[model samples]
Target chain A: MPGKTFEEQVRQELIGLRLEPSQQVWETLAVQLQQKHKRRRIFWLLMLMLCLLGASGWWWIQHNTDLAPGHAWTTHADNSTATKTTTTTTTPILPERIQPDTTPSTVISQTTTIPAHQNRDKNDYAGTADQLPVKLLNRQAPRTNASVNQSGRYTLPVGNHQKSALSKDLQREAVPENGVIKDQKSQPIPAQDNRIKQSVTAAPAFRDTVVISEDSKKSVVSAVLRLPPSDTTATEKNTRSADTAALPVPTHQPVDSTKASVTPATQSAGKSGWSWAVQVLGGLGGTRKSIGSLFAAPDPLRAYNPIGSGSPGSGAGSGGTATGAIPVVRDGASLGFEVAMEKKIGPKQRHLLGLSAGYHFYTTQLKVGARTAGTLLFNNFNVSNQTGYYFASRDSLNYTNYYHFLEAAVQYYIPFSFLKANMRWHTSLGINYLLTSNGLHYDYSGNAAYLFQNNSLFNRLQLNTGSGLDMQLGRKKPVWAGLQVDYMLGNLSKQALSDQHLFRISAILRIPLQKPARK
Target chain B: MQDEKKLVKDCLKQHPAAQKQLYELFAREMLGICYRYTKSMHDAEEVLQQGFIKVFQYLHQYRSDGELGAWIRRIMVNTAINYLKRRPQYQLDLSFEDAHLHPVDNHQPDLRVQMKDLLNLVRQLPAGYQTIFNLHAVEGYSHVEIAKMMGISEGTSRSQYARARGLLISWLENHGINDKKDYYAR
Candidate 1:
């Protein structure tokens, strides 16, 4: 047989070669694989949590946006009417009232009885007439007359525009009209027309009585008004009219009514008012290497040194001494409490400017050490003239720092709808002024005692930026809960003992003291 | 074969016992493969561990059509190449001097030189030469495949394999070992 080639022989010899690995390799591999699996599991769990939070936030936002537009419309209309009524009453003889009625003859005849009541309360009549144009009022007048004729039970016109304003007045008279008009229907058509005219003229007096009722009842009226116009029933109208008549009418009410003027401002404030919130935050903070420490001399005491010169307790030292001390700082926990107020800006009330004052406490432990060596010559000349010694000392210093911070920030809220709740992404940038710091404890051992001072050791200013999700809570949802993380820029340490980059996470509850009324 | 497919599926699910069984079945041969590309047994074992981890991590991507052993071997080879690339000392240069040629005598060969001895001889070659020789000769990768794997030209891979073979043959001959295996036995 021919001899195998070099390559062929080598391939043949090594092709099936196998070498066993030691048992330790398998153990290490198993541990690594288990750790990888654990890490993967943890990553997925966090992803799931994040997805849930996002989904809840989305749901909250959707609920709020869906109701906002309707609520805003009612509040604006009520506020504008209230203001218009007050202005019209104060200036009863305005030139606008003198302008010849340019309306059509049909509208003039329908509204001829309004001028007689207008002389009694100019503001109320003008407000009602101005809001209800001739076209709209005429359409509802025919309906009211037709409903009364058909039902003989004295059904009232449930016009959409007048429903909110007159529902309370009409509700008191509805029950009486139902009983009285049924009996009178057999008497005379002329008598029924006279009664209708009399009831229409008495509306202003009933409105005065409704105004004197509890302010809380006005919200009920506004809510009822929000219902679909077709759903208003004769019984509902009678209940409202009964409620109105039960109250005593005011003889001469003030032109600027408290409920009308105050309610609108309160409602508007609900939408764009100044709001305050208090937050308590706690987190762990780490100190980076200080710039001063980087440039400072290396600690000489780090290495072992033989005793050379002076006795440690001796009062006097003669020879040149070499000492090195380094200050080492460790990470610690931080606690903070803040009270902040925010005001809505812009037409959409999506921008907020806020100012906050807070107090923060940080506790840190520092280790300071020094190694020193020197030769001491004693004046007493008793034994040896030169005493050589080396001594090293380490001391732990605990510091609790209290800082007062004043911060101002501008926030933008991005509103999005998810399911039911109102949610907004609130992002902000702010500057923090360290108003004061206290409880800086300085303690050291041996030659390192001079490094720290109780005062002038920390920078008093920093800038921070953060973002979080704000979710509306409760039925009215006047309260909001926010989760935020703030990163403070710049160093905290003045002398480079530690760098002052701070990270803080906080859960915040915002209560609206006042909000701009949605219009 | 069905058992192997099930074992592979279990390993993909990260079943520890199945992973260990898979490791036990192939680790020894894979270690030998790693040893040829690396300079030391420790490095070979490290490569073997890392390659097995990667195999478990990416096992789901493995198709059922091919043999599991071949797939694992491919991963080990790629891992060894990567390990060489990561080392600061492993430079890809073809400036090595040609091995001195010695005349071969026709004689009865000694079969006593174990496979471990041949492995040791291969391990003694330069990192670049050892990698190319292992890929082409033992792993049966063509020069073109070796070049792509090592990020080098095909001509460079061929020349380095030749140098590596010449050097290994010279060492065996110097040690008085004969190549008596039949060339056409397969």
Candidate 2:
């Protein structure tokens, strides 16, 4: 026989070898796999949410762009003067209360020609003579009694003079009878005469000027005109005025008793009002047992040595040196829900400060006896100080500790730079007063001994700092979805053997309660 | 084959029953392979656990063209190699030159030798010899492949395997097993 047959025989025999593994292997594997599966599910779910967020934002942008076609309704209107020469159409910015109707019946297309003298100071006028006669079209206006010519044009009677003559021309064409302009349908257009009367008095120096308000500057013009409308009720007009009253009124313009409103062209400008949001978070919370900077917890069963002794591994804690005596404490699930009313403050309205009230519960599990007796320590006087609790058991059992807290916190948030503009980092600092359970309690089950709980040791006041990388979704009303990691600065227990501080990592979803105002 | 494809599809869907079924099907054979590479049963089981984890994690990448058992066996072999590299003791043993130790015994025993005896005889070789023997003689890897896997030269792999086989043959002879009948032809 060839010498290779030995190798061949060995290969054949060994390849068919089979050995059964212990059950512990599968049990551990199952736990790890479950965690992996959970992480994977969370990851995919977040990705799906992000994709939906992107899609919704895209749809919103598309929808708004379609609403006012071809008009350059710029957000940075202050710096928009340089590009004004190229813009063919410029309209007076409307307050957020006006939801422009797109019906063709209400569409008003007006071409206003800026006189040559007004275009001389480029810094003041922003547009060249070539950019004159800018066509103003309201594609979203509601169906009204505003008369249009055969070609769908609402011709503004041109004049050689300034603001007063333009107002007089408008008054001559659409004359008010008994303070109300009646449509062709003989329907009364309430407040139409008052708006024209107010515009005539409050109009600025330029006849056809597009005023851009800088971040630092209060507005100069507040001439928002509503022509004769058929369907608009008097109550609706009053409501619209009331909504505008909350906005910053330009000091330069005379306040019309009927309506005095100013439009802040950007989202940053509109963020001054209080916006409430509800935040829901869920994740893992654990106590970090450390002395000073080192994470070494003093071993409770340091004196016990169980090696070479008849000790059941499951019944009693494995006894060895100080390292082996360290107790196993598994972190439990943490969940919290809070409702907060916050306002954007500081420069550019980028920071947020708020007050929040919520409920949170944290749990931790330790393996101990089902029922044990041990020395108890309490803040109050105890006559029977000889190991007050029952002890002496070798049975291993899981004891879950629950700490429930009614949290009242003052939170402050600041922006942080991240990978993408859509994904923003928010750093939050909170000073919290949490009513907690009597901190960590001890029980001597078998070889395991010592505990950190005393009634006086529990500290209800805690301060925490947390940060999250949020994916800001939607433009009209944005929602923030992100992962937040929080660390408590103060220990939950006072005068404990180990310095026990809590830390948690959670997935947070924050939804704003109000829609942001837009121009 | 269709049942296997369905099992794989179900496993990919994260069905716990399907996962457990798949683990039960291959775990015994996989554990045996891990045992041959490690010093103790505990180490073998640890490697088996790690290997099974990788199997489930990258299960989506498995194509139905090859046999599922063969694919899983390949993963187990790779995992065993990694486990050996991770531990300092095994790392020391993996040094082929330093691990060339002489056999301690030359006792003559009964003429009959079982497969269990053969396995114990193979385990007596140093870690380098045992790994090379298992990879070449049993796992059917080429010397070049073994060198690449172990980060050694092809010549070292060949020498290790030869020494491993010689030691096993000498132990078999000492145990009074006839090479022609009990060792190879059986």
Candidate 3:
């Protein structure tokens, strides 16, 4: 009978060999694994924080909208309208959080008092004593009947039946350059005493009368109109009178010569809260060597057997011929795309804070010499192809390394005018967290060249800074298109062998999700 | 196969139980591989510990299309090679007489060589011969691959392997192991 060859016999015998290792090995491995998992937990925690920050920002926008003065009035009035009576009044005081710091100290006395019973009998008169307007009074006056309390807050007695007190602060805001009110067409209005009386009588939709006066004798009230929630298209006659009751006068600033400045400030306050914009960005990037080259081997290879040798060590022992110096190569290009939501942060709408989720693809190309015949090389596991093994037969082989990451980043943009008013320059800073990615590193150390997957090999988080120039496109609701350049500040990989950072140049387009904030 | 897939998935999630189970599944065979490369069981266990760490660290890279045990075995071989290369004591020097040898032609009627004894005999060879023989004859690597891994010419790898094989056969015959029963038998 024919027998197996010696090599085959040895392979067969050793293939089934098993020798159990000591228990200490597993214990050490477990400890190492625990430490690695701890780091992973921290990464996940950062991702969670980014999501929670975006969620909370969204919630704040909704909360502010619900509490707008107009919306709040519509809701509170609808609720309290049922308990309405002629004898009792309820004043809608602005929440302390929203109160302006420069509230005035003077109270306006009612100069033109109307017959309460006469208006009460009218069907159009929704005015109730329980729904009187907020009052401003002198801080120095006696606290007996109408003085502001010690903390400068005075709550009106709801059922007192006395007319609502007018704040001197409100009267000051109502008084402009000439101390008189005017219509939208720049036409001068009627005398102060009669206008206040006529405004109270003409505004039948008001459940409470709006009284604006500096004193009983000199009643100087200006007409600053805010359209009511109901009948937004009504004539200036009714809107100017009715909306005054809902306005919370800002405390500071000298009297403006023109009403244009005050009207827009009031309108924007009621209409705009947080303005969101959608940004679409795409860019090409490349990496620079940061710390060291990962491809350079730690030690030079020494050959056991020399070429044209009599014996293995005849001439190959100490003076072994060295392979040529390993060439230092730079990694290849990277491409990225992101869709983000930007929220205008300040009242002037000059600064924007944004949250983005994006895809970042990085590639590393190297010249791995020709693949030997009948040799197997490992590739990153591609979902499309079940097998990760491939043969490289060409003289020059490029390893198109891929890193697919789901990146979450927080970015802040500071906007300033550049060459013209229409062109804006925005400098931005961003903190990015690469939540998850495939870790594929090409290692040529083993018997065959294979792509090794190790998550700890790459840096997953980094800071980036950039600047962009945006040109306003449209006249009405402007669209902004810009060119942006971003530089990532650190190494791409955690390994000391690589010190490469990513830099990108991109085109960005921004469109407002809501109407642009009032200029 | 389904259980193995689940075990790999769980281990990727860093589940301690699944990790321990995966470790237990391959530890013995891997230690045996490590033992063949090192001088002592202690050194073998050290290589085993380091190799298993790499296995778990890179488990996610292991494509399920291939056998998991085979993937781990490759990593163990790499770790063992690195361990030997790093230490001064285990540094390989394969220089020896490149001479003609008589091929083993005698067929043993009855063979009774204990597996451990055979392993000892193989270990008794020089480190360079032992490594070249294991890489070529046991691991199924070609002379070209061994040459690339050890930075030697393909001709030298083939000659070294031939010398190792001849030495091992002579040692086997001289020990009265051929056609002998119950002599250090398993």
Candidate 4:
């Protein structure tokens, strides 16, 4: 009734305002947010990767203590179980896949004129009487035999006994028959492969015997042998070259000869057959717990608006305006590094699933509202009670104030990937459970310490270091041999500050490691 | 097709397109409130921009409560008031002269014409009378509320509204648009 006429008139005027609607200002805001996320992504990712790497290394080096080699002895010495023996032997050999030995060949002759017990052995295969120089190539057991004691750091004597008729001479300085052995007798007669295979009948024929000298304890095997390419491996090599191809069938092969061979690995593996690689990641980024940053908003004016209150747990004040930039913790730039190992299981599909373990050292920090070394703001931590948000407490970490956090987490990993020439588009997702924490730390009146002495908060917070969507993935065609890129996501909670969530982008290089070959 | 002006831009650039989005989101509500506080559309639009720029500049300050549009409208109203104080407008004279006659009845005037047309009639009043009319009739502000807002006396606000309403009624009559109920009776 009062301003009805005024209101009507105003409506017509309202429609007459600027016809060209604009929102340039908000566009800028969106752009700023995107850029911020991208940059922060690089640093936090580094920290997370480092954390993983460090954790894995620590766990591995600690539990993998049995890597040191042990003694070896004859596992196959049963002269009592003699049965009808044959004089002929046949081998199903794929010659097309066999490459010739390029290493210097030694010609040692072994003439064992033992009392030929008239072919008296049941396990013996029927063989032709072509009395050529019979030389037993090494016979290895399958990986299962030494799985219980397979030292990730040391090679052991599992099985290696394969006899073959050859034109070359047989020389046996000393054959280690059992585990790791330093003292043993030397029997220089060409032995049969069946003897070694039978000794470790329970395992796949790839676990080679770690032969030790009868006098010297040094192992004669210098490196892990490379086996002839398997059908699966051959296809995988091709697919790996195709830039965009399918999973490589498992190509692991058993060595055919001791001189030039690829030793088959004897460790129990996850779905992805390859043993987990320990990767150490290190970098520098923003620290979410800058003292100046924690106190940036200065919760002033506790006026009652009936909306809500900003106390400890009842409600969290929007700590401070996000627009305000935080200062640096150190001058040059904060550096953080972590070590983690990932053991891929499951065949090489577009995505690989596995259980990996690692250690991490991630120290990220950003100056909270820049103050010089000798300045009053940096020198003093006397937080004036601008807002009565805290109960009687002297420490700032107890309340949500100036602080820093150091935490470690164990995670399970899943990786998806695509390859471009020389680059790999990789996406890794993982869930990390915090195992230990050096709670929020800060320079409180120059007394830097952890925020909490114990964990009372009941919430599950995952810190995803640098796992995310990768834009540039593969390097070689389908995939070159060794280059990779990994991204990580790091965060503690939903209401976490931007810096609290770590996102990192990294270039990875993996070297195909070789095991000590059989002599 | 979407307006070329409303194209999305890099938010960091503070591009025109971003501003256009902000404007599109709050324009209607902001205008409705702005018009109630200002004397004219020109004043209202200026106040709208002034308010929008502040909202955008401090956009990052907005946290979880999602309804940013509503929050911005309140700012538009305040901006309109601040604008008037910064650049005051001259008030229209309320001295009633020749046709000042006694009221015939206590009943209110009736109208059957379009709301837009009736509003146009009220717009014909000077700036001072327009503001008081809008504050009382549309915003439901008391004379005291209007006075406090414009830095004027309650008496002045009441007088301005009375004058503005009289002129609107006369304007409607001159248009040969007599009160519908009364004309039906005749």
The best candidate in terms of TM-score? 2
**Candidate with more favorable, higher TM-score: 3 or 4:** 3
> Interface RMSDs of all predictions?
6.2, 5.2, 5.8, 8.7
Worst 10 residues of 4 chain A by lDDT: A86-95
Model 4 Cα lDDT, one tens digit per residue, B1-186: 133222222323455556566567667667656654554554455565567656655665654344565457546655665665554343324333223333322224454555445444555567677666766765567878877877777777777777777776666656644333221010
What are the Cα lDDT values of the candidates?
0.48, 0.51, 0.49, 0.34
Ranking the candidates on lDDT from highest down gives 2, 3, 1, 4
| Model 2 agreement with the true structure over A1-519: per-residue lDDT tens digits | 233367666776677889888776776677657867875786698568656755654454443312111122211111221122212212233322233223332223332322323212233323333322212212122211122234433333222233354445344423343433232233443432222211111122222222211111121222223221211233233323322111111111222211111111122122245546667778887676432322333222321212222232323333332211234466767777787666556775556666677777676655432222455433222321243443222212233456776666665655543432245456666665656553344323334434434445457777877777766654333466788877677866553344456667789877555332122
Q: Give the worst 10-residue stretch by lDDT in candidate 1 chain B.
A: B177-186
lDDT of 3 by residue, A1-519 (tens): 126667777887777789877676687567657756775785588468545744653444332211112221211111222122112222122111112113332232322112222222232223433212222211101111222333433222211222122233233234344533332222344333322322221121222322343322233232222222232222222223333222222121222212211111122222233334555555554454432322232211111111223232223223443221122233444555565655556786456666666766555443323222233322222222113433221112233345555556666655544443345566666666665454344333222333334556567787777778876553223446788776667656653344456556677766444322111
Ranking 2 against 3 by lDDT, winner: 2
| Clash counts for all predictions | 35, 7, 16, 127
Model 4 over residues A308-349: C-alpha lDDT tens digits?
Answer: 332222222223221211112331123222333334334532
Residue A326 shift from truth in candidate 3, angstroms: 11
lDDT of 4 at A14: 43
Candidate 2's displacement at residue A434, Å, is: 10
DockQ (Cα-based) for each candidate:
0.26, 0.33, 0.28, 0.05
In order, the first chain's TM-score in every candidate is 0.38, 0.44, 0.39, 0.30
Query: Against the true structure, whose lDDT is highest?
Result: 2
Q: Mind sharing the TM-score for model 2?
A: 0.49
